[model samples]
Target: MHELIVIEHEAEAGLGFFAGWLEGAGVRCEVVRPYKGEPVPERAGDGLLVLGGAASAWDDEGYGWLPATRALMARSVESGVPTLGICLGAQLMTIACGGTVERGTAGLEIGAGAIEPLPEAADDPLFSALPAGPWRAVQYHYDAMTALPAGAVRLATGSQYPNQAYRLGERAWAVQFHPEASAGIFASWTGTSDMDPLRVADLDARVREAEPELEATWRPFAEAFAAQVAME
Candidate 1:
């Protein structure tokens, strides 16, 4: 069994079903809440996961722990570790791997949305088993990663967001949406500061409407991550 390192950025953005998925696969997880200034472990296992955050990846000074976090993710990439990042975590991974993260024009997608498979995704090992066409994924990010790093494969995209998912090197991957989110987890995200009251309510309804499909997609995504961990 592989030991997974999960970085929690906010009180709301915890691991959700990710921890359960890993445990189900007989993997151990050690999560660190860096926003609370928690102590950073000197070493993270080869399998690493970085969750979302309210803070931007550019604001390393505001969140002083960013440099350290980036260092950890960078090490994971360079060491051939299987690293996965979600939302802001994805942006962090992009920045760590010499990519650009900037404000997106989509204005923060709050509810369930679609991600289409890229032409390059056909050869991807991780995404090969996943469904193509419009698949539902939960998102709540204002900023996005623009260009991908070298050797990164563009796996998925949507109408509004161009780069929904990408894979770095062979083992490192990052997605702009949250595959770890469950129904309860999406409910907890119902009233975040970034979303207005009316928009939040509408988004929650969309989440409920799309719950089944979202869960379906998330199941394989979670399984893919688990499989990557198992490989390490």
Candidate 2:
């Protein structure tokens, strides 16, 4: 069995930078996607990660097998394995852990933006190493977790979003943004056609705008996340 169990949803969406980091770190990784009729991971998985998708956490139980999927996540958490959730993955985390996830006050968050670290992040093990102030990351989501689930510690917030990130107990984390996104992935998400812009029209503009800056920011988050997995 691989040391990590990564749950992937959506057709094109796979493990992002996190997966790359794990592979680079020499950690064996396996992907499970219910959309492809993959099985829900059991306790055998050492660490768990849920990737983002277009689906909502509650839209259709069968489309993504969210109920059982969430149960699998809960089992992983209860078993004390480290787990991470992104976007839809984050919503899944909230629902699995007895927290409520609803539409955010901010309509939609698309493309590169900033998520400020919580005051307490300076002392957090998983987040302490992150850059002190604002950090930019790729984001693409309409639904976000407003209220944290029970047993969760709210670690970070942003100007537009209140519940940007949180930790379940000590080992699990959920973030509304994409720490795993890369230029290729972003381009895949936001087509070159104006019909589907990244955040706004001619959004391909970001490719020229923040490529260097975003890559610079993505490294620390990736490294910090990798460090947490190593801790586990």
Candidate 3:
């Protein structure tokens, strides 16, 4: 069976729905908890799934394992390993490549919002199934990928962040939003973050209502990644 190396940055940002999705697809996941002092491997497994975190990508001093994690991601992308980077993971990939990441000028995008598929995504293996209209997804990042890596294909764009999703080379993909987050996981983030109470409540309600749709849309995307790994 194929294995996907899942990197967990923190305890709060666990795999959520993605765990079941990968298991159902027959992809075994070996999760590395760097926050717990587990060392990140020099090489990736058959595939890689880099989860989100609260720490910035450039905060190497605070998170000592970040440098190794970034190196592994860079190597995976360059070697054509099936790699998926989420939120902070996406920002890390951006910096690993020739791109840039910084505090978002548009402010923190921390709720359920719509991401429209770009024309380039029409033939993308993971994004082609998405509708042309704005597709609802959960967002919780304060930093954003200001620029894409050289030769990267932009997949989706949102109102707050233009670089919502992109594909690096033929195998690596990065998403600024949290497709793996369940309603409960999102709610946990909302409660811990310093945000307006009313806005938090509203977002919690909206995301809870959109749970089914989120599963329906992202499950297939996860499955597609698994299938690619299985084939390889």
Candidate 4:
């Protein structure tokens, strides 16, 4: 069976529905929790999946495991290992591969937001099968990937953040949105935020309403990543 090394940076941002989708597609996941003192391995499994986190990608001092995680990401791209980086994971990948990430000038892009696939996405291994035109996805990030690595193929773009998704080399992919997040996970994130209670409820309700569409859109995306991992 194809196995993926999943790096979980925080308790709140675990794999959630993405894990289930990958497993259903026949990929085994081995999660590494560096937040609880688990050492980040140099290498393990057939592919690598780095999840989103509360910490910024450049905050290696605050999150001690970040340097090692970035190194692992760089190596994964170098060796052409199937890899997926979400949100903060994507930022880490960007910086690790000579790109740029910074706090967004447009402010936090929270709740369900529209993502439009670029022309290049029609040829992408994972994004080619997605629905045409714009689609909604859960977004909760203060930082954005302002620049992508050299030679990276831009796959998708959002109104707030232009670099929403891109492919590095051939096998490594990065996305600024949370395709793995369930409504509950998103609600948990809002609960910890400083947003007003009414606003939080509205956001939560919107995500809950968008749950089916999120599943329809992202499940195939997750499975496509799993299939890519299995091929290696």
Candidate 5:
């Protein structure tokens, strides 16, 4: 069976709906938890999925496995392996490909928000199926991809953060938002940061309300990625 290597940065930010979507598409997944000392693969499988994390991509000293992770991302993209990098993973992909990642001047983009699909996305393998209208997505990141990697095609953009999504090579895709975050996982993220309880509660409610739309928009995207890997 073909495998999709999933890199889970932390325990809390597991694959969520993405795991189920992939499994339903008949693609097996092998998760690697570097935080728990699991080795990052030197070579990728049919596909690679690097999930979200609180840590910055540049914090190699704090997260000793980051350098190796970056190398894995680069290798996967360079070799035309199907790869998807979410949130911090996207930043790492940008940095690994000689792009730039910096603290966002727009402050935190937490909670449910809108992401606009670009014109290039109309023909993209994974993004082509997404709705043409603005899509709501879960956002929780302090850092942003200020510059995309060389030769990358901008698949999507947002008002707060212009670099919302991009396709690196023929098969490598990266997105700044979290399409895989379930309601429970999103709720857990709110309590971690210092914020007003009332505000967190409000955001949690909004995320809950957006669940259906998120599922409609992202579930197909995940399935498409998995199907692509299965075909290879």
Candidate 6:
């Protein structure tokens, strides 16, 4: 079976629903928890999956394992390993490949938000499956990729963040939103955040209502990624 080397940076943000989606599509995942002292591997397996986290991608000093994680992501992209980076992982990939990431002046973009696929994504291997119109996905981030790598193809955009998703080289992709996140996971995030209790409840309720749509949209997306890993 095809296996993806998953770099999970935090406990709350494990693979969540994505693990089951990938496994159901016949791809296995071996997760490496850097927060738990598991070293990020120098190389990847059939594919690489770098999940989101609370720490900023550039906080190597504070996170300690960030430098190695960035190095691994760089190597994965350079070596043509099929890779998918989400949120913080996307920021890491951006910085690792000479792109820019900074705290969004627009503030935090939490809860379910609309993501519109760019014309460039029409032919993309992973994003081509998305609808032409705007679609909703879970989001929880303060930083944004303000600029893309030199050769990266912009795939998706949003009202708040234009660089929502992009493709680097032939095998790697990055997304600012959390496609792997479930409503329950989102509630966990809101629970720990400093947001008002009423706001948190509203956000949680929104995600719960959007759960079916999230599954319908991202399940095929995960399977598409697994298909790419299978071809490797």
Per-model TM-score versus the true fold: 0.93, 0.88, 0.97, 0.98, 0.98, 0.98
Q: Candidate 1 vs candidate 3: which has greater lDDT?
A: 3
lDDT of each: 0.82, 0.75, 0.91, 0.93, 0.92, 0.92
Q: Worst 10-residue stretch by lDDT in candidate 4?
A: 126-135
What lDDT score goes with residue 28 in model 1? 85
TM-score between model 3 and native = 0.97
Once fitted onto the true fold, the runs of candidate 2 whose alpha carbons sit more than 4 angstroms away are 192-201
Scored against the true structure, residue 195 in model 1 reaches a CA lDDT of: 56
- Separate clash counts for every candidate: 0, 1, 0, 0, 0, 0
By lDDT, the better pick of 1 and 5 is: 5
TM for candidate 5 is 0.98
C-alpha root-mean-square deviation, each candidate: 1.7, 2.5, 1.0, 0.8, 0.8, 0.8
**Model 6 per-residue lDDT tens digits across residues 74-95:** 9999999999999999999999
- Per residue, candidate 4 scores C-alpha lDDT tens digits across 1-232 of 7899999999999999987899999999999999999999998579999999899999989999999999999999999999899999999999999999999999999999999999999999999867775989999999989889999999999888899999999899999999999999999999999999999999999999999999999998999999999998
| Candidate 1 lDDT over residue span 11-113, tens digit each | 7888887778778877788888877779666557858889997889889878888888888888988988888889988999899889999888667776688
lDDT of 5 by residue, 139-227 (tens): 99999899888999999999899999999879999999999998889999997879999999999999999999999999999988997
Candidate 6 deviation (Cα RMSD): 0.8
Judged by lDDT relative to the true structure, which candidate is superior, 1 or 4? 4
lDDT of 2 at 34: 76
